[model samples]
Target: MKVKHITIIGLGLIGGSLGLALKKQCGEALKVTGVDHDQETLELAVQRGAVDYSTNDWKRGVEQADIIFLCTPVLQIIPIVEQILPYVKVGGILTDVGSTKGFLAEKLLYMMPSGVHYVSGHPMTGIERSGIMAADRGLFKDKWYILIPEASTSPEAVEIISQTLTWTGARITTMDLYDHDQCAAIISHIPHVVAAALVNLLGKYPALEESFKLVGGGFRDTTRIASSNADMWADICLTNSQPITQSLLQLKELLDEMIQAVEKADRPAIHHFFKRAKVRRDILIEETDSHVV
Candidate 1:
């Protein structure tokens, strides 16, 4: 089914980018409406051509939408979903760009009214900078977009949602909700936590603070995402606490092994650990390179 209009809530980086990408691909065929509490963001989205319509009133934005992308924070996504359930058109599709999927699936499965379809999605793409000003039309290009649909979800709903995402140049991958959260925990959530932890470690030692001034590319690159919005990260960490904690514990176990090996002067074990990591890193680089073209 053709999507005539899409209403994007939040009007932040993800929401604004979706609107821009849709307008670029569908041209006049699709109408994009941007909804946000911030009047400045709504106006910026319109001025930047990311959206055709801007409104602080979500009811007006979503009333006629064929699809609604609830691009709010993870904690806010559920509440917004509840609020908009009554307003969504019958047969209309609703999706999200949240990082965590398990919480959403659990909360929305029974709350979703009949006639409206819900498909949880996470676009594996973003930058440290956020908000409408940082929105980029190419944000999702060639990036992975994971969709988690329940067993009750209609095939037609998944197809329509998949078709809509294709317009943004994303590579769509559908997976079970639990598996999605586990993978995200390892690849995204734990990494952010580690980044922040690394930064915090520096704060703990004021004696080395002066020496830290000489930190180079490695330090900057590793902690680049540590500067992300605190509120957003806090909500994500809370929502996906279980998986994130598991991943962190696994990391701790590995670190303990490495520390013991180094303390024992076990050259062979240290070499083997480094070799294993190098092999995996090389394979990852090779795989990423193969996908570039």
Candidate 2:
């Protein structure tokens, strides 16, 4: 399917950045429209050249769109899609940048209108900051963007979406719904939880102010993601509960091992634990850095 007109719902960081990148790369070939509830955000998106036009009306925004991107929070995506499905042009494609995919794929696969297609996507890139003001056209550059297409989805639709996303400078790959959610739980969801937990733990201290005074790069770097949007993180945790819980339990086990070693003053065990972590983390960083463009 040849994409010409595109509609992006939710003019926040991901949506705004995507609009900017698409506009910059596709130029006059693609007519990008941005939709947000906030009129100020719509105006800002237009001013930033993120889209050709902007609107607060979902129906009007999607009327002429060939591809509609749902960039809202996980829970809001389905409702927004449901509202706009009737307005979506026949043969149009719909996709998302949500964090979780299993539930989305299960529901959206059957929810799409007969001629319209739904493809689940998650871009594995973002910072703690959000909103249109923080959006950068290069946010997705050199990052992994996973596409989850159901068996019912057409190859033409997937190819069209992939080609469009490629213009953002992302490395595109495909994954099944189950695998995508499971891996995301490990890499993204649980890490956010851990970061929040670390910050909360610090907050619980009796001498919190004093302790904060001694904060260094280690604490800042580790807990940077804790500053991410709480509503979005809450939705992610609720939607992907099982995977997140399982990962958290496994993490608890590791923490228990360390706690026991400390309690018993097991020097060798402590040394072994740190050494093993250092080795694995070093290897992981080395492998990841090798892939950077």
Candidate 3:
């Protein structure tokens, strides 16, 4: 549990930023290794000082690791863990930055090697940008990092991973796997889906070219997340389908209510809807801003 050697698989934004933060905060106390399938990414990670070493060999990367971070896309996490299981050091802690956790927790709990511990984690941070080039050392600062540990996960392992993640300046919190997924579906998953849908709606307009000419801060801000990595979002949607589907249905109901009110020219209903949203959004922003460090 004394984490000295850390191996991060998938040197994308989250993984690379984690490496940079760890190296910055922990200095030489931790030996960080960056792993990616792409040799160019590994070189970039090394050049950026994100890790002490970089490699494409999974076995070599994880063999000496005291803690392994799986920062890959949701779909790839399990497969990568399966491949690295044999090489992972005994008593090492395995964690992840995957957005959805229900499926991951279930599978990882069953697949974890006898000696190794699997602790599921999801950092509620990151920009719309992807890749190591977009990695920022301060990305996780003041952001929420949710940990969902399985019953089989040892308390010592949870404490070790939590302590290590603190070096990145993230606010650590724990949640039940099911609760985490459900909450994520509402706050993270649904927002991404809606953002993409808004962009796609604009794309389908007949006067798209003319409409784009009038594009302002509102549209850009609302749809910024639509520019995020498509493959990763797709994987999230697939893995957290149940919660996401239910949330989407609720969203649809709200939208239908708005559509009916507008169709019927019900001015009072429209005004009330916008008023309620404004009040709720204002309170949400106020409360959130109050918590920022």
Better of 2 and 3 by lDDT: 3
The pairs that clash in candidate 1 are none
lDDT of 1 by residue, 1-293 (tens): 77899999998889989988999998888999998989899899999999999998768988999899989888998888877787888989888888988888777877878898888899999888889998999999999999898888878988999999999999998989899999999989998999999999998999988899999999999999998878788989998889999999999999998999999999999999999999999999899778864
Sorted on lDDT, best first, the list reads 3, 2, 1
Per-model lDDT: 0.89, 0.92, 0.93
**Which model, 1 or 3, shows the larger lDDT?**
3
**What stretches of model 2 exceed 4 Å from their correct place?**
none
TM-scores of the models, in the given order? Answer: 0.97, 0.97, 0.97
Q: Which candidate do you rate higher for TM-score, 1 or 2?
A: 2
Q: Taking the tens digit of each residue's C-alpha lDDT, what string does model 3 give over 1-293?
A: 57789999999999999999999999999999988999899999999999999999988999999999999999999889989999998898889899999888888888987788989899999899999999999999999898887777788889999999999999999999889999999999999999999988876777667858788899999999999999999999999999999999999999999999999999999999999999999999999888888
Model 1 residue 31 CA deviation (Å) reads 0.4
Count clashing pairs, candidate 3: 0
Candidate 1: stretches off by over 4 Å: none
Cα lDDT tens digits for candidate 2, 1-293: 67889999999999999999999999999999999999899999999999999999988899999999999889998888888998998999999999998878888888987899888899999999999998899999999999988788888899999999999999999998888898999999989999999988876777667758788899999999999999999989989999999999999999999999999999999999999999999999999889987
Best candidate, lDDT-wise?
Answer: 3
Better of 1 and 3 by TM-score: 3
